[model samples]
Target: MARPLLRLLAASCALGAMAGSAAAQVADHGAPWLENPFPSTYVPLPRSDVMLRHATILDGAGNRIDDGDVLVRSGKIAAVGRALANPGGAREIDARGRWITPGVIDVHSHDGTYVLPLTTIDREAGDVSEGSDVNVADTWIETAVNPQDTAFSRALRNGVTTIQILPGSSPIFSGRAVTVKPIRATSVAAMKFPGAPYGFKMACGENPKENGAETHRGPTSRQGVVTYVRKAFMDAQQILRDQKGEDGKPGPRRGPPAGRGPDLKREALAGIMAGDLRLNMHCYRADDMATMLSVAKEFGFHITAFHHATEAYKMPAALREAGTCAAVWGDWWGYKMEALDAVRANAPMLDRAGVCVTMHSDSPGSGQRLTIEAAKAAGAGRRMGIVVPPERMIRWVTSNSAKVLGLEDRIGTLAPGYNADLVVWSGDPFSVYTKADLVFIDGAIAADRSAPPASPASDFELGRVAAVRP
Candidate 1:
């Protein structure tokens, strides 16, 4: 981690400014870069109070309303119905043929973390894993976040307003993941999602083993990985029992870990045990996910979601019972042994069996068409005489993913109290020719197909790289 970030974390922890009252009790040696500016570069347009009348609306909660009206006031969905009594001063648009849905929430992305110029001839510039020890939970992707990444522009045009930038999963534990609004900002802190809890990344398959083998570490097998995880948490538990409170004395056992951790790794592990940090575990096989669930249960820490779980369909019942969501692709299989047994219906099958299912793009290009990915996954179920409606398929990229990221309360659904993060599609979102005609982030226009929308372009791309589409 960078020295500036460490200084900020130290200052925030010392002043009790990280977040909430619990920050005073939580361990102070991890990623706590919570001092953020307003949503970076996202200018609120004059039409902050606008109403879209007579459109097909997908609430992102499995409800579809034809000829619906959504009124946005003060960056919130004020009303949603067939005929809303519009405010006299609000701007109104007759969206007759368009469809409105909540802005896409990408659960697993490496955009800022693996920023522009991914490859520099010799090595990838933003490889964010400490492979030497395979347990750098103290490290954070935020310090590596390059807000100048041009990928943010493409995603915004595709209706993605929010995304979780996670660390690479090459090691057993990479580090803490940061959530951000996909705005091309001057710095990552300016784009950080307010009030969103921090997440940690953990991988449990071929990548970790390979990294360990290359580094001459001990965790060369799955058993070894499991053993290492157990010991790390147990050690963290002991440390949590040995920290001091903000008043320079041991406080009552309430929320968060007991006190400050001696190191970054211990602080993060303690955060997980305190039950506020979300774990975005990268596992491909069903057996590995099953074992992970058992481990999470033993440690009393929840596994929020399993990323790239290609074989999630094989263990839908277990996943559903464990209350963990699966973030997967349309048909990314056969590339590796663990991911080889996957079928295209993996997502659909998981959906049918009552497991929380979502489609995610670990690749930057694939992320541009995540709606198409969900359409394909739903199409696979259609061939099998099972129907995955567009309304439900939308959740595979919107609500379901948001729930996994712990931002469901604020942004996912197009409800009355949720953030007015929505996209207006020219046609059915699942249709190949459809494009995001107008996108709203917090009720402000972020993109438009008809006009040159606000520039999501980074300062780095302003003069050097011209805008291709807009």
Candidate 2:
């Protein structure tokens, strides 16, 4: 169920206070901070009083408005045109010769779940698995989310305003995923999009096998993987049926509601079955991808996106027909047998076939710099004679990702009524040397390379730089 807007605002306020308190405590200890040195002081100001003028606006809708002025007020884009009525007391920013676009969104990421500055062993500490079963349908990535991680700042620096933090695909049905803002807040609620549906993390091939060897349970083989997912959905259907009365009255409310469950796995699966949760499946091969689509059809649920779909170009028509999204890498290939057919032209081919394709960087190192990934896709498409436009290519990492995460209306474009989440680039964003000059999330400045924020000390980063200096 979606949280009330008031509740979300209150939660954000509480979490902000908690984050401030945590930072103060860490500083009191007089120790170096192990987390990112950036501060997370996001105080939302009145957006009605800000405007960016004389900029080339690349609206993520595949349109470019040159020498335009964008007026934002109350955190929503109010006007975008050549001439603007500047109300009194509005701050006008000179953006001449610069490019403005929606802040980049990474549809596939693992930053929050497997957070750095903490031991990797903590990922396994919580029983993310249920009953020792691989397909834990009730586990939520948000529940285990640690909001104080340093990767949020790094993501902000790279112009990534939002990301879907997914669990590692160690199981066929890994767990639920969360869509989060790459900002500093003390709790998951503050960072979470208020009503965004949770996502089920399903996987195929290598990651599902136990101990790198086939076991007796389902999904030991490729066929087994398909069967396992089908069976689970069938069970969920049965549960759904039993929970509803023949007279159209609710029956005993099933096991439990979302976000509160004795059986964590089933709780997560229930959300999917009820169409309240999206499915973000990870598959590499074309055949497996087809089978997964078939399973979705049999269960009457839609797949939001397929991550790391290296061979998606082969079945672009099918993917397009089903309205499924392909979140893929630009040129990563041959790391395994399933990924052998990965080609540089994959994204272009899919795009030409009218598939909603988005490029993603699954690596921690690569996640912070996905503009380069989009550039690579554009370069590959151009090399293959695809002639994809620059505006269209930018959509692969911005608007298309927002579509996959079901947040297209809010942050993926610089249009009227959209949230003021945008990035100012130092040069043409497609160029290799281009960088983010400023990043705004919900009309608040989150990152400005020209004037960086004061570094906040945590227990682990105190005086270490000075001590190591020559």
lDDT of 2 by residue, 32-127 (tens): 111122223344533445888898888899988889888877777778878788876668989888888889888877776565544455445332
List the candidate 1 regions with Cα displacement exceeding 4 Å: 1-47, 121-124, 243-261, 453-470
**Best of the candidates, TM-score:** 1
Q: Write the per-residue lDDT of candidate 1 for residues 1-470, one digit (tens) a residue.
A: 12232233345454554454543434343332232322333444445699999999998999999999999999999999899997787899999999999999888898865666656621466655656578988787778877778788789889898888888888798888888887657787778887687888999988888777877875899888999999998877654444334653333333334474346677678667655578999999988999989888777777999999998988888898889999999978898899889889888899999999988989787788889999888889889977988888899989998898888998879999898999999989988899998888888887777886455555656655667996
Using alpha carbons, what is the TM-score of model 1?
0.87
CA lDDT, every model vs. true structure? 0.80, 0.72
TM-scores of the candidates in the order shown: 0.87, 0.83
lDDT of 2: 0.72
